[model samples]
Target: MDSAPIVVHPPTGSGGRRVTVRGEILGLAHSDADVVEFLRRAGLPDAEGLLDDSAWVKWRGGRAHHYEAA
Candidate 1:
């Protein structure tokens, strides 16, 4: 199977940022909005705070990603 893609967003001050890319899991995430929520629940850094400095980072040809939590 393919790994899930990671989306990074800069901080927004509210502590929650934005998910740049969506994941694979439908219940977990498959769209931008769903990805954002998934990260939030995953205990990852708040997306709102990372919105201004985050973005959709992907490999050259790979869909999966490894994000450095800020």
Candidate 2:
């Protein structure tokens, strides 16, 4: 399988997930909009659309849209 370019790491104690693109750490995201904004700042176009595209984003240690740690 092809690896995704963006990775949304598991939520931290503060309920924020770490967003990374191409191995570069973007920032902590508390919501989908935050993720999109991070991507936008990283010079990515159509970042909102990328959130749902599995080929573009890989959500690890939790489900997509889930920010609270279990």
Candidate 3:
């Protein structure tokens, strides 16, 4: 099994609840670059302030995408 870890920091001054976000991606059915590109295309920014744990991962010819949070 292959797993990757990502970290994110929630935005401030958004008038919402604040929280620290940490994500663990396990068993991605593709290369790390592909998975990262997929996440990036799905509006998951590669910056702090984006929800790292709650992002879409599209796989299998872009037919399936799952959202996971931790």
Candidate 4:
């Protein structure tokens, strides 16, 4: 598995994705803003910008910015 600092897990049945930072579960995010907020709270700089940065975040089971399950 990729060892990125942030990982946005696959969306759940309710379309919420689990956001984790350094293996720490931040929360379940339903939107990009929620993920950004989680990162902000975790003290990560430029949280929103990191969304598209593969080196910073690893998006699993979905494309970037996609909250709904495939």
Candidate 5:
């Protein structure tokens, strides 16, 4: 099976959802450029999504897009 490592960092004072793939930072996990491009690169098209808006602690891995609030 093919799998990709997706890491998410909680947003800062004026930042958006930050994510990493294979240990490389990918900007915002909730943005079209970052997270969307990531899913396409990982070949998980249907896994695109946004994270919950309540807390800053979220999932660490998935074909799905995950993020944390600041």
Candidate 6:
């Protein structure tokens, strides 16, 4: 099976980097809105609804960044 690309957006003042995971990480952003922006930029379908148990991201950077439900 194929997986999603991993995109990492640098942190602004949130302390943690924003990440969008389709299969891996499609892109990064500061917030879900930004993440959607990334999706718009990529010209890809919004997979925000696909975020669930299938996506397991363990950040070694301590606490997780702010993310929104798809």
Q: Highest lDDT, which number?
A: 2
- The clash count of every prediction, one per candidate, is 22, 0, 0, 0, 0, 3
lDDT of 2 by residue, 1-70 (tens): 3299999999998788999988889999999999999999999868998898999999988789998865
lDDT of 5 by residue, 1-70 (tens): 1133655655544545666655666566565456667656766564454333213224444323433344
lDDT per residue for candidate 1 within 1-70, as digits (tens), equals: 1133454344334333344345532232333455446656756557444433424343222232323222
Cα deviation of 69 in candidate 3 (Å)? 26
For model 2, where is the 10-residue window of minimal lDDT? 1-10
List all candidate RMSDs to the true structure.
11.6, 1.8, 13.2, 1.3, 7.6, 6.6
TM-score of each: 0.29, 0.90, 0.26, 0.90, 0.45, 0.40
Mind giving the per-residue lDDT tens digits that candidate 3 earns over 1-70? Answer: 2132332222223221121213443223223444455446545657323323334221222222222321
Overall local distance difference test of candidate 4:
0.89
Question: Candidate 3 — what's its lDDT?
Answer: 0.31
Can you write out model 6's per-residue Cα lDDT over 6-69, one digit (the tens) per residue? 3434454534455654444555555556655666565646545433323433332323345422
Candidate 2 TM-score over all chains jointly: 0.90
lDDT of 2 at 67: 87
* Model 3: colliding residue pairs: none
Q: Give the per-residue lDDT of model 4 (tens digit) for 1-70.
A: 5679899999988788999988889999989999999999999768999998899999999777888854
In candidate 4, which residue pairs clash?
none
Q: Which ten residues in a row have the lowest lDDT in candidate 1?
A: 60-69
lDDT of every predicted structure (CA atoms): 0.40, 0.90, 0.31, 0.89, 0.50, 0.46
